[model samples]
Target: MSLNSNLARKVEVEIPLQSPSNVPEQSTGMVHRSISKKSLATRVEKMLMGIIMAIAFTLIAVSISLEINIASTNRALQDTKVSILNTTTINSNLQQEVQELSRYDRIYRFANKQGLKMNEANVRNVVK
Candidate 1:
Protein backbone atom coordinates (compact mmCIF):
# COMPACT_ATOMS: atom_id res chain seq x y z
CA MET A 1 0.00 0.00 0.00
CA SER A 2 2.79 2.42 0.69
CA LEU A 3 4.60 1.54 -2.72
CA ASN A 4 1.31 2.07 -4.65
CA SER A 5 0.77 5.48 -3.04
CA ASN A 6 4.33 6.54 -3.98
CA LEU A 7 4.10 5.50 -7.73
CA ALA A 8 2.07 7.47 -10.30
CA ARG A 9 -1.29 5.96 -11.57
CA LYS A 10 -0.89 3.84 -14.84
CA VAL A 11 -3.02 4.75 -17.85
CA GLU A 12 -4.69 2.08 -20.15
CA VAL A 13 -5.02 2.58 -23.97
CA GLU A 14 -7.68 0.79 -26.19
CA ILE A 15 -7.29 0.16 -30.00
CA PRO A 16 -10.66 -0.25 -31.86
CA LEU A 17 -10.88 -3.28 -34.30
CA GLN A 18 -11.31 -2.48 -38.01
CA SER A 19 -14.80 -3.32 -39.38
CA PRO A 20 -15.49 -5.00 -42.85
CA SER A 21 -16.70 -2.63 -45.60
CA ASN A 22 -20.24 -3.15 -46.90
CA VAL A 23 -19.92 -1.35 -50.29
CA PRO A 24 -18.26 -3.29 -53.18
CA GLU A 25 -15.65 -1.44 -55.31
CA GLN A 26 -15.13 -1.99 -59.02
CA SER A 27 -11.63 -2.86 -60.32
CA THR A 28 -10.10 -1.32 -63.46
CA GLY A 29 -8.76 -4.60 -64.79
CA MET A 30 -8.85 -8.03 -63.20
CA VAL A 31 -6.87 -11.13 -64.30
CA HIS A 32 -8.52 -14.54 -63.85
CA ARG A 33 -6.85 -17.99 -64.04
CA SER A 34 -8.42 -20.48 -66.62
CA ILE A 35 -5.51 -22.41 -68.17
CA SER A 36 -7.05 -25.92 -68.39
CA LYS A 37 -10.23 -24.85 -70.26
CA LYS A 38 -8.50 -22.53 -72.83
CA SER A 39 -5.66 -24.90 -73.69
CA LEU A 40 -7.93 -27.45 -75.49
CA ALA A 41 -9.58 -24.72 -77.60
CA THR A 42 -6.19 -23.33 -78.63
CA ARG A 43 -4.97 -26.80 -79.68
CA VAL A 44 -8.10 -27.41 -81.76
CA GLU A 45 -7.68 -24.07 -83.56
CA LYS A 46 -4.07 -24.85 -84.44
CA MET A 47 -5.03 -28.31 -85.77
CA LEU A 48 -7.75 -26.81 -87.96
CA MET A 49 -5.32 -24.26 -89.37
CA GLY A 50 -2.87 -27.02 -90.19
CA ILE A 51 -5.57 -28.98 -92.02
CA ILE A 52 -6.56 -25.94 -94.05
CA MET A 53 -2.96 -25.25 -95.05
CA ALA A 54 -2.48 -28.87 -96.10
CA ILE A 55 -5.59 -28.74 -98.28
CA ALA A 56 -4.39 -25.52 -99.90
CA PHE A 57 -1.03 -27.07 -100.72
CA THR A 58 -2.71 -30.13 -102.20
CA LEU A 59 -4.93 -27.99 -104.41
CA ILE A 60 -1.93 -26.05 -105.69
CA ALA A 61 -0.10 -29.26 -106.51
CA VAL A 62 -3.12 -30.60 -108.40
CA SER A 63 -3.42 -27.43 -110.43
CA ILE A 64 0.24 -27.54 -111.40
CA SER A 65 -0.12 -31.16 -112.51
CA LEU A 66 -3.18 -30.29 -114.57
CA GLU A 67 -1.31 -27.46 -116.27
CA ILE A 68 1.52 -29.80 -117.19
CA ASN A 69 -0.91 -32.34 -118.56
CA ILE A 70 -2.64 -29.73 -120.64
CA ALA A 71 0.65 -28.60 -122.12
CA SER A 72 1.60 -32.14 -123.09
CA THR A 73 -1.82 -32.73 -124.63
CA ASN A 74 -1.55 -29.56 -126.68
CA ARG A 75 1.85 -30.65 -128.01
CA ALA A 76 0.44 -34.02 -128.98
CA LEU A 77 -2.48 -32.37 -130.77
CA GLN A 78 -0.08 -30.17 -132.73
CA ASP A 79 1.94 -33.22 -133.78
CA THR A 80 -1.26 -34.93 -134.89
CA LYS A 81 -2.20 -31.90 -136.97
CA VAL A 82 1.19 -31.90 -138.67
CA SER A 83 0.86 -35.61 -139.50
CA ILE A 84 -2.61 -35.05 -140.92
CA LEU A 85 -1.31 -32.23 -143.13
CA ASN A 86 1.46 -34.44 -144.50
CA THR A 87 -1.02 -37.22 -145.25
CA THR A 88 -3.30 -34.78 -147.05
CA THR A 89 -0.41 -33.54 -149.18
CA ILE A 90 0.53 -37.09 -150.13
CA ASN A 91 -3.09 -37.87 -151.01
CA SER A 92 -3.33 -34.82 -153.27
CA ASN A 93 -0.13 -35.80 -155.12
CA LEU A 94 -1.46 -39.34 -155.62
CA GLN A 95 -4.74 -37.94 -156.97
CA GLN A 96 -2.82 -35.81 -159.48
CA GLU A 97 -0.80 -38.87 -160.62
CA VAL A 98 -4.03 -40.89 -161.00
CA GLN A 99 -5.59 -38.10 -163.09
CA GLU A 100 -2.54 -37.98 -165.37
CA LEU A 101 -2.61 -41.76 -165.82
CA SER A 102 -6.33 -41.76 -166.73
CA ARG A 103 -5.69 -39.89 -170.06
CA TYR A 104 -6.97 -41.60 -173.32
CA ASP A 105 -3.44 -42.01 -174.77
CA ARG A 106 -2.15 -43.60 -171.50
CA ILE A 107 -5.22 -45.88 -171.27
CA TYR A 108 -4.77 -46.97 -174.93
CA ARG A 109 -1.10 -47.76 -174.36
CA PHE A 110 -1.91 -49.62 -171.20
CA ALA A 111 -4.66 -51.67 -172.96
CA ASN A 112 -2.32 -52.57 -175.84
CA LYS A 113 0.46 -53.61 -173.43
CA GLN A 114 -2.08 -55.80 -171.62
CA GLY A 115 -3.16 -57.44 -174.93
CA LEU A 116 -6.78 -56.28 -174.31
CA LYS A 117 -8.51 -55.64 -177.65
CA MET A 118 -10.84 -52.60 -177.59
CA ASN A 119 -14.34 -53.49 -178.93
CA GLU A 120 -16.00 -51.01 -181.21
CA ALA A 121 -19.19 -51.09 -179.17
CA ASN A 122 -17.22 -50.44 -175.86
CA VAL A 123 -15.07 -47.65 -177.33
CA ARG A 124 -16.93 -44.39 -177.95
CA ASN A 125 -15.39 -42.93 -181.11
CA VAL A 126 -14.50 -39.31 -180.29
CA VAL A 127 -13.63 -37.05 -183.24
CA LYS A 128 -10.99 -34.97 -181.49
Candidate 2:
Protein backbone atom coordinates (compact mmCIF):
# COMPACT_ATOMS: atom_id res chain seq x y z
CA MET A 1 0.00 0.00 0.00
CA SER A 2 0.97 3.62 -0.51
CA LEU A 3 2.00 5.99 2.36
CA ASN A 4 -1.41 7.94 1.94
CA SER A 5 -3.32 4.66 2.58
CA ASN A 6 -1.33 4.08 5.82
CA LEU A 7 -2.18 7.67 7.00
CA ALA A 8 -5.92 7.12 6.15
CA ARG A 9 -5.94 3.92 8.26
CA LYS A 10 -4.38 5.73 11.22
CA VAL A 11 -7.04 8.54 10.97
CA GLU A 12 -10.01 6.06 11.27
CA VAL A 13 -11.64 6.03 14.76
CA GLU A 14 -14.14 3.52 16.35
CA ILE A 15 -16.53 3.96 19.42
CA PRO A 16 -18.91 1.68 21.36
CA LEU A 17 -22.77 2.22 21.07
CA GLN A 18 -25.60 1.55 23.61
CA SER A 19 -29.19 0.27 23.08
CA PRO A 20 -32.31 2.57 23.66
CA SER A 21 -33.31 0.51 26.70
CA ASN A 22 -30.06 1.47 28.52
CA VAL A 23 -31.02 5.24 28.46
CA PRO A 24 -32.77 6.87 31.48
CA GLU A 25 -36.59 7.13 31.39
CA GLN A 26 -38.48 10.37 31.97
CA SER A 27 -42.15 10.49 33.30
CA THR A 28 -44.74 12.29 31.12
CA GLY A 29 -47.75 13.19 33.37
CA MET A 30 -49.87 16.19 34.44
CA VAL A 31 -48.19 18.46 36.98
CA HIS A 32 -49.97 19.15 40.28
CA ARG A 33 -49.63 22.67 41.79
CA SER A 34 -51.17 24.32 44.88
CA ILE A 35 -53.27 27.51 44.43
CA SER A 36 -51.39 30.69 45.45
CA LYS A 37 -52.80 33.88 46.98
CA LYS A 38 -52.04 37.39 45.69
CA SER A 39 -48.80 39.08 46.81
CA LEU A 40 -48.90 42.00 49.35
CA ALA A 41 -47.70 44.58 46.78
CA THR A 42 -50.37 43.52 44.32
CA ARG A 43 -53.08 43.76 46.98
CA VAL A 44 -51.88 47.21 48.06
CA GLU A 45 -51.86 48.47 44.46
CA LYS A 46 -55.45 47.28 43.96
CA MET A 47 -56.56 49.03 47.19
CA LEU A 48 -54.93 52.30 46.11
CA MET A 49 -56.63 52.08 42.70
CA GLY A 50 -60.01 51.52 44.39
CA ILE A 51 -59.56 54.59 46.61
CA ILE A 52 -58.54 56.74 43.61
CA MET A 53 -61.57 55.61 41.65
CA ALA A 54 -63.84 56.44 44.58
CA ILE A 55 -62.37 59.92 44.89
CA ALA A 56 -62.75 60.54 41.16
CA PHE A 57 -66.38 59.45 41.25
CA THR A 58 -67.05 61.63 44.28
CA LEU A 59 -65.57 64.68 42.55
CA ILE A 60 -67.70 64.02 39.50
CA ALA A 61 -70.85 63.76 41.62
CA VAL A 62 -70.05 66.98 43.49
CA SER A 63 -69.39 68.84 40.24
CA ILE A 64 -72.71 67.71 38.85
CA SER A 65 -74.50 68.93 41.97
CA LEU A 66 -72.73 72.28 41.82
CA GLU A 67 -73.68 72.67 38.16
CA ILE A 68 -77.31 72.00 38.99
CA ASN A 69 -77.26 74.54 41.81
CA ILE A 70 -75.64 77.16 39.61
CA ALA A 71 -78.25 76.65 36.90
CA SER A 72 -81.09 77.04 39.38
CA THR A 73 -79.49 80.14 40.91
CA ASN A 74 -79.11 81.70 37.47
CA ARG A 75 -82.78 81.08 36.75
CA ALA A 76 -83.76 82.65 40.05
CA LEU A 77 -81.58 85.66 39.32
CA GLN A 78 -83.21 86.14 35.92
CA ASP A 79 -86.65 85.94 37.48
CA THR A 80 -85.69 88.55 40.07
CA LYS A 81 -84.40 90.85 37.32
CA VAL A 82 -87.68 90.48 35.42
CA SER A 83 -89.68 91.23 38.58
CA ILE A 84 -87.61 94.30 39.32
CA LEU A 85 -88.09 95.59 35.76
CA ASN A 86 -91.87 95.11 36.04
CA THR A 87 -91.96 96.90 39.39
CA THR A 88 -89.91 99.78 37.96
CA THR A 89 -92.37 100.10 35.06
CA ILE A 90 -95.30 100.15 37.47
CA ASN A 91 -93.61 102.79 39.63
CA SER A 92 -93.01 104.98 36.56
CA ASN A 93 -96.70 104.74 35.58
CA LEU A 94 -97.81 105.67 39.11
CA GLN A 95 -95.45 108.65 39.19
CA GLN A 96 -96.94 109.90 35.96
CA GLU A 97 -100.49 109.60 37.40
CA VAL A 98 -99.43 111.51 40.53
CA GLN A 99 -97.93 114.32 38.42
CA GLU A 100 -101.10 114.53 36.31
CA LEU A 101 -103.37 114.61 39.37
CA SER A 102 -101.21 117.20 41.12
CA ARG A 103 -101.26 119.69 38.21
CA TYR A 104 -102.42 123.17 39.32
CA ASP A 105 -104.78 123.64 36.36
CA ARG A 106 -106.64 120.29 36.90
CA ILE A 107 -106.89 120.91 40.66
CA TYR A 108 -108.14 124.43 40.06
CA ARG A 109 -110.78 123.20 37.58
CA PHE A 110 -111.96 120.52 39.99
CA ALA A 111 -112.10 123.00 42.85
CA ASN A 112 -114.12 125.49 40.75
CA LYS A 113 -116.52 122.72 39.75
CA GLN A 114 -116.90 121.91 43.46
CA GLY A 115 -117.87 125.56 44.10
CA LEU A 116 -114.75 126.18 46.26
CA LYS A 117 -113.57 129.84 46.31
CA MET A 118 -109.81 130.26 46.22
CA ASN A 119 -108.35 132.67 48.84
CA GLU A 120 -105.06 134.02 47.53
CA ALA A 121 -103.92 135.06 51.08
CA ASN A 122 -104.57 131.55 52.52
CA VAL A 123 -102.78 129.71 49.72
CA ARG A 124 -99.20 128.79 50.54
CA ASN A 125 -96.75 127.40 47.89
CA VAL A 126 -94.83 124.54 49.54
CA VAL A 127 -91.32 123.74 48.21
CA LYS A 128 -90.15 120.13 48.47
Q: Estimate, for each residue in 23-60, the C-alpha lDDT of model 2 and write its tens digit.
A: 97754431211112345567788999999999999999
What TM-score quantifies how close candidate 1 is to the native fold? 0.61
Alpha-carbon lDDT of model 2: 0.86
Give every collision pair in model 1.
none
Question: When superposed on Cα atoms, how far off is each prediction in RMSD?
Answer: 15.4, 11.0
Q: Per-candidate TM vs. native?
A: 0.61, 0.68
Off by over 4 Å in 1: 1-33, 113-117, 124-128
Candidate 2, run of 10 with poorest lDDT: 29-38
Q: Write the per-residue lDDT of candidate 1 for residues 21-126, one digit (tens) a residue.
A: 7546645343223554577689899999999999999999999999999999999999999999999999999999999989989999998999998888886766
lDDT of each: 0.87, 0.86
TM-score of 2: 0.68
